[model samples]
Target: MNIELHPRLAADCHRLGQVPEGLVLLQRNASLPWFLLVPATPREQLHELDPELRHAVVERWNRLAAWVARRFDCTRVNVAAIGNVVPQLHLHVVGRRHDDPLWPGVPWGQTLPARAYSEATLASFQTELASALDLTPAPR
Candidate 1:
């Protein structure tokens, strides 16, 4: 299988976005510490991925959840698979907080879009997370 990420994700990849190591993308969305993980397979749908790869992705999610919980002091981690628009296989790992502006409710459709991170902040967070994750660049 090839690794064909969405155009936005591809742009993120090129920009060297701070997503978790081995888990491609890890884009920081404007909402609830949202991040997207692009598995290194040319798979558009989740079911198309082999079981092992699927398991690996899940593992990555778990690892990332831990990372988010500790880093953000989030009360919970929301991991979802909703391929409404981007059909490419990806996982959404969100850092949640009870006091978060939209706590006790779904973050989606509950608030305005995210604000882009400042250059310095984005760079620092990216580097910090990448180091903490101890990521290994996946093979193509």
Candidate 2:
């Protein structure tokens, strides 16, 4: 049950370092709109994840995807669990737009990261998602 995030994931998840129980740090390039749900389980494979956690992971991804879709007003949602590069037990829920940079193709291409949200925007999203995600106050 020894599991840790990949370096890339760790760096991307730095903002959620203070996240508390029930909330997971979803990481991605933040440019093409991607999300990875890090379940609390210490499994390196999805099958290794317990039933309860498996369900929770699914629910989390779906809910987050819905939120992103409504917020971004996207046309479709493409979600999957690609463990090819990082073998962590996590799920990806991506919001796809017909006019997005990688529209009509997978959004896995390399590119410069997007402009990070201002502190205000981050606070706003975190707060907006609080009720749905049960987000807690990040530790000071």
Number of the top-ranking candidate, with TM-score as the measure: 2
Alpha carbon lDDT at 60, candidate 2: 71
* TM-score for each candidate, following the candidate numbering: 0.73, 0.78
Candidate 1 residue-wise lDDT, 30-124, digit = tens: 45676666776667667778898777777777777787788789998888777776766777777888877777887644554566655675555
lDDT of 2 by residue, 1-140 (tens): 12366776777653342223234554434555565666666577767777877777677777878887887788887777777787666666677788777777776544644646455656666676676566653432
* Candidate 2: residue 86 lDDT (0-100): 72
Estimate every model's Cα lDDT from 0 to 1. Answer: 0.64, 0.62
Q: Which residue pairs clash in candidate 1?
A: 2-42, 30-114
Which window of 10 residues has the lowest lDDT sum in candidate 2?
A: 14-23
Q: Show where candidate 1 strays beyond 4 Å.
A: 1-4, 8-23, 26-31, 136-140
What lDDT is obtained when candidate 1 is compared to the true structure?
0.64
RMSD of 1: 4.3
